[model samples]
Target: MALPYGFVKAKIVSTPQLKSTRRPHEVQYHLHFGITVNGAPWDIAVNVGTTDADDLLKYQLVFDFRHSVLTTLKSTSPGSTDLTGTDALPALDFLRSDFLAKTGAWRNSDVMDGSDQVEPVASLQRLLLRAQQSSLDVYVFGRFYSEGDGVHDVHMNQGSRGEFIHHAGDDSNDHNDIWQDGALLVDLGEPEWALYAAAFDQQYVPTDDLGNPAPGSQPIS
Candidate 1:
């Protein structure tokens, strides 16, 4: 039997430095998972893990739990161009149903409009909280363009690559033109969980040229 939705635990295992560019990247991490439905361990994987991080931009995190891939919660950034402009509000909605259906937890999730909202800090926090509640291990592998503002940073410019547009007589574009930079994988192992979460949060915390989380910086939440 599977564990109850909120009975799982989280911890960091390992941390690896990753380089991000306009390309797809993959990283593998080990985890120990313990699931209990009625105070009894139902499923335990000492090494259950996932691969791939190809959708990190549009989704804050791409998690593969027990071979099931889930797109992380996300909100639009400011200055982004969308078909419908100025009417979009960043709120947690698109993935609400999917998340609730998949993990049986919906405490934290959000969607933000890029044109109206400038930051997605609160959305990120909700995602973290939900991840904790569901006991659904997470692996984040992907890259997002930073817009210089800590709070309003993470953004992916898919249109810059002609993904969502098709011009008259244009035949060289594809819908899936987006590239993944890296991925995050979650392990039920306490150590692995902690490491993965730290890496992800650190990356989003904004850094200097040296890639260090800015000092005295409070990440938007």
Candidate 2:
């Protein structure tokens, strides 16, 4: 199916900024670009920061799809009443060690526990190893839409996730931005369903190794 109105030709416009600080340890920032179906500009921003022992960073992004009439229609009124549990899309999550293992970049060392919901430590180990070897750039894209039997049906999927590392002092723009580009198309299971377009960018610190800081080690700066 064709992508929603505003997202048809979306594009990513900037590189992310990475900052090493004593307060937060690590901070990353970036942005994305697109135009709504009505031709209004769509801009999204993301920020992420992390401390030493965490395998994940605190992440946040601003998404503005208000100009998307189709999204507004589907998210409100009689259209929303038709949705069912099955119509809800899966949640999009950050990449973790388990995901890396599944992708053949590493091996799983810990038993799978459903309650943890966090990525395995092995993945963080691999990521830190890579980071130490060279600066790494990672990108992620998220697309949300509706399809099948319900009008308010929602679905989410990742376009791609990958890493590119550069030598330590290369200064070749090692920083990475995750808000590349994305598109969404809602079928609403009917011809009358409106079309919406959404484009967003996310900037966040990469997950660090999951362990306590080394004794006497200073924070990043």
Candidate 3:
């Protein structure tokens, strides 16, 4: 399950801040960016992180979710999951946890040893830099707070259970399928724009949300 909106074609407006936080019942790394949509001020948390799992250093970069929209790649990923980008994609279109690991362009030499937090941050810095100057279409699930409103779940959001299943919230206003979520589309004008999708846990939410795990109990699986 994901936000009612599909994605926001956006531009990164400033230098983003990278941060790791242990807030409430979860741990996450957030890339906070300031953005403007049609000259209207808005912020984007171009985030990729984990929850309940210590594997924060591992992430995948899907270099072709929308690449087929421009070029002729025989196959964008493994199996029948052809990321040809033939039409406007919804977040639910990508729901596999192993989508990037199996299909995206990541080198074996790029693996980060599970020792510290440098791996994801280093890679993200480069990606954010690419996004700073290049035009980007941030595919997202919308989340709104009183102080702000922005797209979240900038990662994969399927293969989930319990309250984390995005459909658990706002039934009438959400995508009802079991598998669906968010991602990013980067345009380089090279006839091959790239898309990167990530996932943490669909069960993780704000302290007040209905799906959030109960206090002092186990976090969502």
Please identify which of the two predictions, 1 or 3, would achieve the higher TM-score against the true structure.
3
TM-score of 3: 0.59
lDDT of 3 by residue, 1-221 (tens): 23334445566778777655675756666677766655666666655554545433224565544433323222232111222122233323442223333455322112232223454556666676787877554333334322555555555343334544333535543222333345555665555555554544333322222232335533222
Per residue, candidate 1 scores C-alpha lDDT tens digits across 1-221 of 11001112222222211212222343322222223332333322211111333222223333433322222112112121112111111211111112213322212112222221221233333434455565545433222112221111112112222142424334343211122112233454433222111122112223322222345543322
lDDT against the true structure, each candidate: 0.25, 0.24, 0.45
Better lDDT candidate (1, 2): 1
Candidate 2, 82: how far from true, in Å?
Answer: 14
What TM-score goes with each of the models?
A: 0.20, 0.22, 0.59
Off by over 4 Å in 2: 1-9, 13-28, 31-37, 46-221
Cα RMSD, each candidate: 18.3, 19.4, 9.1
TM-score leader? 3
> In each prediction, how many residue pairs overlap at the backbone (N, C-alpha, C within less than 3 A)?
31, 1, 6
Model 3 pairs in collision? 91-181, 92-180, 155-198, 156-198, 164-202, 164-203
What C-alpha root-mean-square deviation, in Å, does candidate 1 show against the real structure?
18.3
TM-score of 1: 0.20
- Order of models, best lDDT first: 3, 1, 2
* Highest-scoring model, lDDT: 3
Per-residue alpha-carbon lDDT of candidate 2 for residues 146-210, written as tens digits (9 for 90 to 100): 33211110111111122222223332322221222222322222232211212112222242221
